[model samples]
Structures are given as structure tokens and as C-alpha cells.
Target: MFDEFRAKRVLSRCVDLRKEIYNLPSDLNKLRKTDPKKYNDIKIKLRDIV
Candidate 1:
């Protein structure tokens, strides 16, 4: 039962990661200049993912 729950949780997170990756801006340089906060946030997220 615990394993099944863990599998579902992991699957949900995978979908979330896919959505975040898909929606990320193509121009990160522009983002870094325009919105440093969001750019840094994205960097932190990517760091954790990788």
C-alpha cells in the first residue's frame, strides 16, 4: 500500500516537472534582465531537479 502511494506521488511530480519544463521561457537571458527574481527561482528549481 505504501509503495503504491509512493508511485502515484512520483508520477504526479513527474507531470508537474514536465509542465514546468514545457512552460519555461526560451529567453532566459531576457528573463534574467527583466525579472531577476523569477530567473533565480527558475535556476534554483532546475538545480534541485538536476
Candidate 2:
């Protein structure tokens, strides 16, 4: 039972991470247009996260 629960949790976390990664490009674009200075830092952070 514990193993099954852990698997479910991991799968859900992976799905959430995938969603974030997929949305990253749009976020970068918006940041670049709005705050060019911070864009590079965010891009690097997002790269590390992925």
C-alpha cells in the first residue's frame, strides 16, 4: 500500500513538472519583453530546474 501511494505521488509530481516545463517558453518570452534584465537569470534558473 505504501509503495503504491508513493508511486502515485511521484507520477503526479512528474506531471506537474512537465506542465511547468512546457509553459517555460512563454514565460521566458514575456519576461524578455517586460524585464529584459531579469530574463537571463530566470532562463538560467528554469534551465537548472528542468
Off by over 4 Å in 1: 1-10
Clashes of 2: 0
Q: On residues 1-50, what C-alpha lDDT tens digit does candidate 1 reach at each position?
A: 56998888878877888899899899999999999999999898878766
Tens-digit per-residue lDDT, 1-50, candidate 2 = 56998888878877866776676666667879988877776566557655
Clashing pairs in 1: none
> How close is each model in CA RMSD to the real structure?
2.6, 5.1
Query: Residue 28 error for model 2, in Å?
Result: 6.5
| TM of each candidate vs. truth | 0.68, 0.48
> Least lDDT summed over 10 consecutive residues: which range in candidate 2?
41-50
**Per-residue lDDT of 25 in model 2:** 61
